[model samples]
Structures are given as structure tokens and as C-alpha cells.
Target chain A: MAILNLKKIGVSGVNSALHKIVENSEKDFEIRNPQGQHSIACGINAPLNVEIKGHVGFYCGGMNKYAKILIHGHAGVGVGENMMSGYIHVKGDTSESAGATAHGGFLVIEGNASSRCGISMKGVDIVVGGSVGHMSGFMAQSGNLVICGDAKDALGDSIYEANIFVRGEVSELGADCIEKEVRPEHSAKISKLLKSSGINANPTDFRRYGSARQLYNFDVDNFESY
Target chain B: MSEDIPKTHPRKSATFDDYTLSEIRRAAATGIYDIRGGGAKRSVPGLDDLLFLGASLSRYPLEGYREYCGTDIVLGSRFATNPLKLKIPITIAGMSFGSLSAQAKEALGRGASIAGTSTTTGDGGMTKEEREQSEILIYQYLPSRYGMNPDDLRKADAIEIVVGQGAKPGGGGMLLGQKISDRVAEMRNLPKGIDQRSACRHPDWTGPDDLEIKIHELREISDWKKPIFIKIGGARPYYDTALSVKAGADVIVIDGMQGGTAATQEVFIENVGQPTLACIRPAVKALQELGMHRKVQLIVSGGIRNGADVAKAIALGADAVSIGTAALVALGDNNPELEDEYKKLGTTAGAFDDWHEGLDPAGISTQDPDLSKRLDPVTAGRKLSNYLKVMTMELQTIARACGKSHVLNLEPEDLVALTVEAAAIAQVPLCGTDWIPGKKNEILLS
Candidate 1:
């Protein structure tokens, strides 16, 4: 395993070193002293294990693909943004817009997530251990967001086909987002996702939320809803 | 004798014409408003209202045959380690891949590369073909963050954060379902066959202070190599320019109301933002006041048609000009040859603005595979390059006539406005008069 110390090399130097490593498709990486710097490990394409020991700033692991990134400390806004076909594990809390606009990825936030979590998410599967702030999964088109803890107000506003599974106390749903029956098939999927995320929660404990389907097709009779 | 005279009925009011009546009727018939491409259709003060004062006696003109007038400009020299050095002072404005066919994007790239200038990867991120074709590609960071990826950000020669556009300052852009091809849908991370509306504001940052940080972050991401440009719609030019300068922009792009878009509400297009003619002077003033004039390059866009417009913009203290609508026209959009097809679509050639419909005959604006195949990128690219060459030569001719050694040396003193409104906005003297309305008192006091 190669160890990258941010304090010694600086942000650009470390990032460049990581980028070169990814380009070469090398071994696992251990990053130290991230020191809340932004864009840590961004644009990494090759399959590798990247472990950051300390806190990171915004856009950490952004545009990640075919890599596994594990952040030991808290992350700032837009963590794992626009990631495609990767796995990101944030050990601590994350700021707003976590996993935003990500198409394909598995993001696991071990701690709480701020507002707009999974906002505009396309196909990423996000599992948050702690509570999520308001407006989580706003305009989510695809994928699944499994929140282990309580959800704040206005959750899943203007959501599309994406599924939301919340375990704790309910908050108000946003426009077009409504509670749905958690069938056996959904519970099975939740169980698999929980296992993949390494969460111990029972799948049956959660409730599912999704688009009301009233907006799937526009009708002049439903004009006011628009 | 009376029968021999042709009977003439009361003429329709020029102010409330056929098109106006049609628009009203259409609006009433359909609850939703019209969304289309192109800029303001209304006539306003533009570069056409300005003319250069050629040198005769007081100023000596350069011999057109022997003398050389330079047009080279270096952008993003303020803070960027690697700046873009262009042979001409014109760059292609951002047009998204989703809004325009891939062939059109490639054509834009080819033309800009041939002309030794830069092209932009507009809203929907950068396509691989566009990246490979464009010599110097500027990546536009828009509000939606659609298709924005770190790889493309690193690949760009420069990055432009689009705060607003001239056609619709505060309005978001729309990509109708028809234009959202499979590739476009994948790039934008949206479902296929669904209407997509980009956000009006960025999700992360709110205002100027946040914008400053965002710019810093981008610089770090690109290793401080690429120049960062702040593009704003021409609303409050002075304030926006000043704020952009303060936000650490290496370059500023002010787009006027005449700037075209892929699709936006007609109301926003025709009734929003200031004209290009009224945008340049105030922006220049802001730069000058901040002691950053020429240090941070200014690229003005919107309704820039010919070489005269380019010269006029440069004379008014703009370092460069960007073209969008004109560029599309150069690439054979709304060509006269496609007039019959356009008529079938219920519009004429030169008036074709319904780009969101995905039924373009010229194939430049649509996502339909059959329609897009109509445009041969190679031929269209050559045409664009030829147009660019003509404009460059025209700019040189004007510069030579004005006795300027370099295009950048052309100043406001060499221009006179034909209209009072233009004279006031451009701060140039009206024809046959020594007065610019707002500046006369300042000149007298000075």
C-alpha cells in the first residue's frame, strides 16, 4: 500500500500523485492529513482502494468511477458528486448535497447527512446511518436512498421513480413524493442494500417512499398540480 | 376612372402586426407560453448603429497593402499559469451538446481550431468529439451541473462559470424531451424522453462571496493552470463586472440580451437584460475603476454579426467578443436552401428559432438522428472557417482605416453613434456633433 501525506506534498501534489497512480492502475492508497482540503481524490477512474484518514472538504471523490473510496473523517458538501460505478464510504457526517447527481455508485454515509442529501441523484444507492436533513433526494429520478435514522421535513420533494426507505420517525413529504407500501420484494432489496452497506438494521423496520405516479403523465385536469 | 384605381383597405397597425396577433391568439389557445431559441427579436440599439471615423487629415491611415494590424489577444493572464493565446479576438460562445447536435458541436470545434481561436463546451458538459476537435476548449460550469465531471474540468483550457445569460438573465434553460437523446440523457444523468429544466441558481453557492470560493476551488482542481471566467447576463453590468472581478475572475464574459439560447421562454428572451450595445461601456467602466482593466480580459457576446461589430466592441474597451447565433448561422443554420422545409414547419428560413422542437431541416439544432445526419460537419466546418476569415479581414480593414496598429488600440474616439440612445449608452459622440448625452457634462467639467 502506498501512503500519501497531504501535509508533505500539498493538495495539488497529492492529487497529482493519486491521479498518476490511478492512471497507472496501481495498488491501494492510504491518504493522510487531508486537512479539510477540497477535491480530494477527484476524477479517479481506475479500480483501486483509496483510504483517506482525515477530514475532507467539498467535492471529495467527485466523478469517481471503478474505485472504492473510504473517508475516515467528516466530509464537506457534494461528497461523491457525479460518481459513476464506484463505492464511497464516508465514516462521519457529510454536508449538503452528498451523492448529488451521481448516476451509478454505492455511497454509504456512516453518520448524519445535511440537507439536499442525494439531491438530483440519478442511479446511485445511498445508505445513511444517521438522520438526514430536509429536502433529501429532491428530484431524484432513479436509485434508492435508505436512511437508517429519522428524516427531516420535506423529504424527497419532486421525486421521480427513486425509492426511499426511512427507518425512524416520519417527516412531512414534499410535493409529489408519497409513502408507499413496503412489499416483500422491497424488503428483500433493502436487506441486500443494508448488507452491502454493512448496516445491522432490519429491512422490515423501514417504510418506503416514492413518486405518487400522478405526475408520470400530464393531464389538463391535473394542471394545478404542476 | 374610379374603377381603374386599386381599392386599398385599412392597413394593419405596424405596432400590432400579424405576428403579434398570432402570438396573442396562440397564448390564449394554449395555457402554456411559447419556448424557443434565438435572442431578442425586437429592434434595439446594436453595433449597426455605430460607425468608425476613418482617418483622413487629423489622423493618418495605414496603407492597407503594406501596413500590419495585429489582432492577437492573450486571455487569463491575470492568475492562470497557462493562458490562452489567440490569433484573433473572437471566441465561440457556449452551446450545449444537448441543445445542438453532436455534428454541430464538432463543426464549431473544427471552425474555432482552424481559425486559431477557442470554442466552448456549453451547459451539458463536454463531448469527446468536441474535446478532440477543439484546440482550446473552455468548459462552462453552469447552474445545473449537468454532465459536469472532474475529468472534463481538468481537460479544459479554461473554465467559465455561467451566472446568467443575456437572453434570459434569471431564467433557466430548457431541453425538451425531443432533444434528449440517449447519449444526452446519460451525460445529463436524466431519464430519456423527459423534459429537463436546469436550475436557475447553483446548488452550492448563493452569492459573490461563495462564488469567490467556488472559483478558488476550481483553480485548485485544475492546478491553477486554466483561466477562470465569470459569465453574466447584462443586467447591472457595472455591479456584476465589479463583483466578478472581486470574485477573482481572470476573465469576464458579459452577454447581452441579443445572445441566443437553445430554449427559453419568449417573454424572458425578448424582455430581459440589457442590449449588447449598452453592456460594454459600463463593464469597461467597472474594470477601469477597479484598476483591473486589460489585466482581466472581457469577452462580450450577443448579436455580434460582422467584423464591424467586432471592431466596435474592441474599440469600446472589450478585449474580445464571443459569437453564438452568428456561429450557428455560419454553420448553415436556417440556410435559404432549407426554406421549403422551414415553411413546412410553419416558419421561414432566417426566422427559424424553434430549436426545441427537434425538427430542424439544417440538422444543426435537432437530436433526431435522421435530421442530424443532414449536416456534414466537414463541409459546415469549412464554411464556418471561411466566415471567420472574412470577419477577421473586415476587422483588419476597419483597424487599418482607423490608423490603429493593433485591434486593441482602437478606442471610442474612433467611433460615432448614429442614434441618441446608442450615443448615450456607448458614450460616443453622435454623428456631426461633439456631444454624447450623459458624458457631455463630464467632458465640460473635465
Candidate 2:
């Protein structure tokens, strides 16, 4: 394992190391003293294990593909944004737009997530252990979003097909978002996601939410609604 | 058919002609306004109304063959570690991959590369072909954030944060279902065959203070190597330019009302924003007042068709000019060879503006496999390079005639407006007069 101290080497050194490591490396990297640095381990296409210690800033492990990233501390906004096929484990809390627009990835946030979490998410499975703020999963197209704790207002607003599993009370639902009955298959799926996220929760306790699909097609009658 | 018979024929008003009537009827029938591509169709004051005062006995002209005229410009030298050195003052504006075919995007890259200028990736995202073909690729960070990634950001030579587009300043963009191919769908993270509406505002940042933070974030992401550009519509150039400068922009791209789009409401496109001719002086004034003129580069775009337009924009105090509609034309969009196909769609070749329909015969705007195949990137790229070369030659000729060693040295003093509207908008003197509109002149006491 190679350890890169961000405080000692700085961001440029870290980026250069990451870029070079992406070219040739199958080894693990431990980044220390992240100190709220943005875009750490960004655009890493290689299959490697990256562990960042301490709080990191926006876009941590952004656009990550074929790499496993573990943030041992709280992450800022856009953690694992636009990520394609990767596993991001955030050990602590996160700010806005967590896992935003990610296509294919497994993002596990242990703590609470702020507003707009998983906004415009496409095919990324986001499992948050704690609660999520308002407007979570807004315009979400696909994938699964599982929240262990309570969900705040406007959950899954303007959503499209993406499944949402919330264990606790939801404040409100936004336009086109509806709560559906939790089926047996949902229990099995939520069971798997919860287990992977390392949460001690029962899958049967969750409710599934999704798009009502009314806004899919534009009609003359729906013009006033728009 | 009588030789001297006075015939009564039903005549239509030229002011409200067939097209206008059709538009009114269509609006009345549909209830929803028309959505189309390209810029404003109505005639507005443009660079065509300006003429350069070429050197005569009053000034010495440079010999065309012997003398050298510089056109090189360094962008993002204000704060960026690695600034961009463009060989020409012309750049290819941001046109998304979804709006244009992959081949068309590649062709733009090839042409820009051949011309030693830069090509930009618009809303949808950056493509591999675009990244590989173009030497200097500017990545656009739009409100939608479709296909935006950190890797592409680092890969780009510069970054353009799009606050607003010239065509529709406060409005969002629409990509119809027909044009959204599987590849485009994958890039944008939206389902295929669904009408995609991009956000008018960014998801992360809202106002200028947030914009400042966003710029800081981008700089931190790129390690301050890439130049950060802020592109704004020409609605409020003075305030917009000033705000962008405060937001730590290395370059400011001001796009005017005449700028093109993939798809937007016709009303928004035609009604919103200031004309390109009227925007330059105010933007220059803002830059001068900030005492950052020439330090932070300004790129003007919107209906920049020829070298004369480029010369005029620079004279009006722009560092560079970006072209989109004209670039598409040079790439053989709306060709007369496809006039039959265009007529079948109820429009003529030169007048066709329904680019959102995805039925372009020239293949520059469509996503259909058959249509896209018609545009060979190499052939189209060569044509674009040829057009760029001609434009550069024209600019050189104008610069030589103006007795300027460099195109950047072309000032407002070298220009005279042909019309009062043009003179007022351009803030230049009218021809055969020493008067500039909106300027305080002192009557000399002899």
C-alpha cells in the first residue's frame, strides 16, 4: 500500500500521483490529511482501492470508474458525482448533491445527507444509513435509493422509475412522486442493500417510493398542470 | 391574359408575409409556441452595417506580401498556470454532441485543430473523438451537468461555466426524443426516446457568490492549471461582465441574441437578450472600469459570419470571436443540394430552421445512422478548414488596409457605422461625420 499525505505533498502532487497511478497500478492508495480538498482521486479509471482519511471537500472521487473509494470522514457536495461503475463508502455525513447524476455505482453514506441528494441519479444505488434532507432524488431517472432513517420533505420529486426505500417518516412528496406498497421482492432487494451498507435494519420496515409517471407524455390537458 | 387588362390580384403584405401568417396560424392552432434551433430570423443591426476606414494618404498601409500581421492571443493569463495560446482570434463555439452528430463534432474538432484554434464541448458532454481530434478542447460546465466529470475537466485546456446562452438567456434547452440516440442517452444519463429538459440554473451554484465558490472549486479540481471562463448572455453585459470578473474568470465569453441553439422557444430566442452589435461597448466599458481590460480576455459570439465581423468585434474591444451558426453552414448544414428534402419538410434550404426535427438531409444536426453517415468528418473538416483559412485571409486583408500590424490593434477609430442604429449600438462615428451617438461633444469656440 502507498500512502500519500496531502498536507505534505499538496493537491498537485496528489493529482499527478493519481493520474500516474491510473496509468499503471493495481495497488491500494491511502490518502491522508485530505483537509477538505476538492476532486481527490477524480477520474480514476483503473481498478484500485483508494482510502481517504479525514474530511474531504466537493467532488471527492468524482467520475470514478472501476475503482473502490473509501472516505473515512465526512464528504462535501457531489461525492461520487457522475461515477460510472464503482463503490464509494462514505463513513460520515455528506453535504448536498451526494451521488448526483452517477450512472453506475454503489455509494454507501453512513451518516446524514443534505438536500438534493442523489439528484438526477441514473442507475447508481445509494444506501444512506441516516436520514436525508429535502428534495432528495429529484429528477432521478433510474437506480435504487435506500435511506435507513427518516426522509425529509419533497422526497423523490419529479422522479422517473427510480425506486426509493425509506425506513422512517417522510415529510412530504413533490410533484409526480408517489409511495407504493413494499412488495416481497423489495424486501429481498432492500435486505441485500442494507446488508451491504452495514446497517442493522429490517427490510420489511421500509416503504417504496417512485414516480407516478404522469409527466412522461405532454398532453393538451396537462398543459395547465405544467 | 389580355395585354392591357388591369388585373386585380390578391396581394399579401410583405411585412406580414406567408411565413408570418403560417406562424400565427400555427400558434393559434397548437396553443403551444414553436420550438426550433438556430438564431433569430428577424433582421437586426449587425456587423454588415460597419465599414473599416482603410489607410489612405492620411495613414500608411502595410504591404500585403512583405509585412507581417500578428493574430496570436493568450487566454487565461490572469490566474491560470497554463494559459491558452490560440493562433487565431476565431474559435468554434460550444455545440453539444447530442445537438450535433458524433461525426459533426469530430469534424469541428478537426477543423479547429487545422486552423490552430479551439473547439468547445457543449451541454451534453465531451466525446472521445472531440477530445482526441482537437488540440485545445474547452469543456463547458452547464446547468444540467450532463456527462460532466472531473476527468474531462482535467483533460480540457480550459473550462467555460455557462451562466446563460445568448439564444435563450433565462430559459432551459430541450432535446426532442427523436434525436436522443443510445450514445447521447448514455452520455446525458437520460433514457432514450424521452424529451430531455436541461435546467436553467445550476444544481450546485445559484448566484455570483456561489459562482465564486464554484470557480474556486473548479480551480482546485484542476490544480489551477486550466483557464476558467464564464459565458453569459448579452442581456446585461455591464453587470454580467463585472460580476464574472469578480467571480474569478480568466476569460469572459459574452454571447448575444443572434447566437444559435439546438432547441428553444421561438419567442424566447427572438425576444430575449441584447443584439450582438449593441453588447460589445458596454462589456468593454465594464472591463475598462474594472481596470482588467486586456488582462482578462473577452470572447464575443453571436452571428459572427465573416472576417469583417471578427475585425469589427475586435475593434469594438473583444479579444476573440466565436462562431456557431456560420460554422455549421461551413460544415454544409442546410445545403441547397438537400433543397428537395427541405421542401418536402415544408421549408426551403436557406430558410430551414427546424433543426430540432432530426431530419436534416446534410446530416450535421441529425442522429439517424444513415443521415450521419453522409457527413464524412474528413471531408467536412477540410471544408471547414478552407472556410477558416478564407476568413483569416479576409481579416488579414482588413488589418493590412487599416495600417495595423496586428488584428488586435484594430480600434473603434478605424470603423464608421453606415446607419444611425448601427452607430449608436456600436458606439462608433457615423460615416462622413465626426459624431458618435450618446457621447458628449463640445462645440469649439473659434
Candidate 3:
């Protein structure tokens, strides 16, 4: 295990140190004093275990692949953004666009997440512990977004093939997005995601929401929806 | 008595032209607006209105065969560790694999490699064949982030953050169901036979301030090795250019309304943005005001056709120019050879812009198996290389005639405009007079 302090070396040094780790090494690293700095521990390509001790800013752990990152405090916008393959565990709440456009990854937010969570997610599986704000899961292409607590307004707007599992009430649904029955397979999938993210929740208690697919092809009837 | 009879002269309304009337009828019949490929077709004051002022009695011209005029340029030298060194100032603009056949993308890569320039990937992510064929490939980071991954980002030579395209400046990209094959569907992570509309704005961040941070993240991802380019449409060129520079871009690509799109509404194409001729000077002025001219490179595109357009763009203070529509034309798009097939599709060879239909006879802008196989990548690549070579030669000829040792040495003083609109837009003097329409000068040619 190696210890790197952000206050001591700055963002560039911390990133360089993370990049130096070899692929599949599964190395352990502890970063101290993140100080809400942006882009800390970003672009990690190797299979390493990284733990950030304090709060972080935008794009923390962005485009991360093959690494397992644990954020000890709150994170700002776009954490784990565009990540290809990795595991990011945020211990506290996150700001808007959390896990935005991530292709493939497992992002577990233990606390509440702000608006636009899981927006445009390609294939990542995100499990949120607390409530999420408005416009969550907007335009999600392919993935599973599991929200254990209540969800705010306009949930799953313009969603694609991705599935959304929400436990509590939702204010509204966006175009082409609708609530569907939670089947046995969905329960199993949600259960697996929750177990993997270490969240204790009954899969049957949640409802599945996805695209009605009405807006998939352009038609004059759906013009008002657009 | 019948011989003395006179017939009333027939007249037509200029406002309701033939094309306009046809469009109105078509819209009334089908409740959908027209969607097509390529750029605005209406004539605008562009490079054709400008003429090079060759060497006269006051200046000496270089020997055509003996004197050397350098065409080489280096892009991304401002902040990047390793910049692209090209033998010419012409580059291939971004065009996606979903909108175009894989063979077309490969052909563009191969041709650009042979021409010693770069090619860019578009909305649909980078393809493996394109990566293998291209010597220098610029990965476009778009709002949709379709097929966006870290492995490909690392594989790319440079990263271009696409804020907006010229064809639909404020609008998003649309890939109709006809063009979305199984492969394209998997890459974009969408249903196989559904319309895909990309977001006009990026999902993660907004505004220039956020863009600066986004650029930082990308730089960290690439270890600050790759050059970052910010591509903007012709709308608000001056402010956009300055903002891009402030956002830590090593290169700024300003695409005018004449730039091509794979598929977009015709109204947005014709009604949205400024012409190529009207966009350059303001962008250049922004760079000069910041004292970053020549430090941060500018690559301009839209309506670039021949070598004259290339030279004219450089003289207007662009470091390089990119071609999209012209490159496709060189690769046999809308060829007269396919005239019969085009007519069968209810359009002439030169007027075939329904690329969204995916029934292209030339096979460049299609995903149909049979149609796509018609275009041989090697042959098409060779044709594009040949066209690039000719354009480069023509540019050198103009530079030599203007008594310049390098193609970049050509300045605004080396050219004169034929029309008042051209002179005003290009910020150059009108021919036979020293009058620039918008500028007030103390001394004038009398």
C-alpha cells in the first residue's frame, strides 16, 4: 500500500502516481487531503484499489477503468463520468450528473444524489442508497439504475433500453418513460446489484421504469412529445 | 384577324419559386419536414468572389518549377507535448461511421494518411478499421458520447471536443432508422431500427467555465500528451473563438454553415448560421486580440472546394482547412456514373442529398450490405489522395504566384474581392479600388 497526499503533491502528482500503477496489479493506494479539488484520482486504467479520504470536486474518478475507487466524503458533479469499467463507491452525497455517460462500470452512491443522476449512461450499473433529485436516468441507453429511496420529479425521461428500479414515489415521468411491473427477472437483477453495492433493500419493494419506446421512430403523432 | 391577336405574358412569383412551391406541397402532404445530408445549397459570397493578386512590376514572382513553396504545418503546438506534423494544410473533417459506411471511414483514413494529414472521427465512435488505417486520428467527444470509452480515447492521437457542428449549429444530430444497422446500433447502444437523436448540449457539463474543467479531465486522462481542440459553429465566431481559447484549447476549429452533416433538417441547415466567407475574419480578430494568433492554431471549414479556397482561407488567417463534402465527392459521391440509379430514386446525380434514406448508389453514405460493398476502400482512398495532391499543388502555385515562400505566408494583401459583399465579409479591398465596405480608411485609391 502507498500513501499520497493531495495537499502535498497537488492534483497532477496524485494522478501521475495513480497512472504509474501497472495493469492487473490490484495495488492498494490511500489518498489524503483531497480538499475538494477537481479531477483527483482520474483516468486510472489499471486494476487498483484507491481510497480518497476527503471531499472531491468535478470529474473525480472520471473515465476510470479497471480500478476500484472509494470516496470517503461528498463528491461534486460528474463523478465517475464516462467511466469504461470500474467500481466507484461514494460514501456520501453527490452533485448533478453523477455517473453521466459512463459506458461500463459499477458506481455505488451510499448517500443522496442530485439531479441528472445516471444521465445518458451507456452500460454502467448504478445503485443509489438515498433519494435522487429530478430528471434522474434521463436518456439512459443500456444499464441498470437502482434507487433505494424516493425519486424526485421527471424520473427516467427519454430512457432507452436501460432499466430503472425505484422504491419510493416519483413526481413525473418524461417522454416515452413509464412505470412497468417488476417481474421476477427484474427483482433478481435489482437484488444482485444491491448485494454487489452492499445496499440492504428488498428487490420486490421497488418498481421498474423504462422506455415505452413510442418515440423511437419519428411520427407526427409523437410530435408533441418531442 | 387571328394573326393580330396578342397573348398575355406569363409571369411567376419570385417568392413562390418552383422549389419553394414543391416544398410547400410536399410539407402539406407529409406532416414532416425534409431531412437530408450535405450543407446549404444556396449561393453565398465565398472564395469564388476572391482573386489572388499575382506578382506585378513592383514584386518579383518565383520560378514555378525551381522555387520551393512550403506547405507543411504543425498543429497543437501551443500546449500539447506531441503535436501533429503534416505535409499539407488540408485535413479531413469529422464524419461518423453510422452516417457513412465503414468502407468510407476507412477510405478517408487511408487517404488522409497517404496525404500526410489527419482525419477526425464523428458522433458515432471510432471504428477499429479507421484506427488501423489512419496515421493521425482525432477523436471527437460529442454531447451524445455514443461509443465513448477510455480505450479508444487513449488510442486517439488528439481529442476534439465538439460543441456544435455547422450544419445545425444549435440542433442535435439525427441518425434515421434506415441507416442504423445492427453494428451501428450496438456501437451507439441504441435499438437496431430506431431513430437516434443526440443531445445538443453535453450531459456532464455546460458553459465555458465547465468546459475548462472538462478539458482538464481529458488532459489528465491522456496524460496531457494529446492536443485538445474545441469545434464551434459559425454562430458568434468572435466570442466563441475567444472562449475556446480561454478554455485551454490547443486548436480551435470553426465550421461555417456550409459544412456538411450526415442528416439534419433542411430548414436548420439553410436558416441557422453564417457563411464560411463571413466567419473567418472575426475568429482571427479574436485570436489577434488575445495575442494568441499563430500560438493557438485555427482550422476553418465549410464550403472549401478547390486549392483556391484553401489558399484564401489561410490568407484570411487560418492555420489549416478541413474538407467533408468535397472529400465524399472525391470518393465518388453523386458521380455521374450513377446517374441512372439516382434518377430512379427521384433525384439527379448532382442533386442526391437523401443520404438518410440509406439507398445511396455510390455506397459512401449507406449501411445496406449490397450498397456498402460497392465502394472499394483502396480505390476510393487512392482517388481521395489524388484529389488532395492536386489541391496541394494548386495551393503551392498560388503561393508562388503571390511571391510567397510558404503557403502560410499568403496574406490578405495578396488577394482582392470582386463584390462588395465579398470585400466586406472577407475584410479585403475590392478589385480596381482600395475600398473595403465596412472599414473607414483615411487614404483611398482615387
Q: Tell me, by TM-score, which candidate is best.
A: 3
Residue-by-residue lDDT tens digits, candidate 3, B1-446: 69779987888889999999999999988889999999999988888999998998866788886899999999999888989899999999999999999999999999999999999999989999899999999999999999888889989999999999888899899999998899999999998999998999999899999999999999988889999999999999999999999999999999999999999999999999999888899999999999999999999999899899999999999999999999999999999999999999999988999999999999999999999999999999999999999999999999999998999999999989999889989989988788888785543663
For model 2, residues B347-388, the per-residue Cα lDDT tens digits are 998988888878888998899999999999999998888888
Provide the lowest-lDDT 10-residue window in model 2 chain B.
Answer: B437-446
1 against 2, candidate with superior DockQ: 1
Per residue, candidate 3 scores C-alpha lDDT tens digits across A116-193 of 999999999999999999999999999999999988888888899999999988888878999898888999999999
Q: After superposition, how far is residue A223 of candidate 2 from its true place, in Å?
A: 1.1
Residue B266, candidate 2: how far off, in angstroms?
0.4
Which lDDT value does model 3 have at B119? Answer: 97
Which lDDT tens digits does candidate 2 get at residues A86-182?
Answer: 8999999999989888888799999999988888887899999999999999888889999999889989987887999999899999888998988
Writing each residue's lDDT as its tens digit, candidate 1 over B1-446 gives 68989989989999899988999999788866788999999999999999999998889898885899998999999999999999999999999999999999999999999999999998788999899999999999988778887778888999999999999999887898888899998887777877777878776667897688677667766778999999999899999999999999999999999999999989899998999989999999999999999999999999998899999999999999999999999999989999999999999999999999899999999999999999998888889888888899899999999999999999999999889888998999987787899757433321
| Per-model DockQ against the true two-chain complex | 0.37, 0.34, 0.88
Give the CAPRI class of candidate 1: acceptable
| Best first by DockQ, ranked | 3, 1, 2
Return the DockQ of model 2.
0.34
Flag regions of model 3 displaced more than 4 Å.
A23-26, B1-4, B441-443
lDDT of each: 0.90, 0.88, 0.93
Q: Give the TM-score (0 to 1) of chain B in model 3.
A: 0.98
- Candidate 2: residue A29 lDDT (0-100): 89
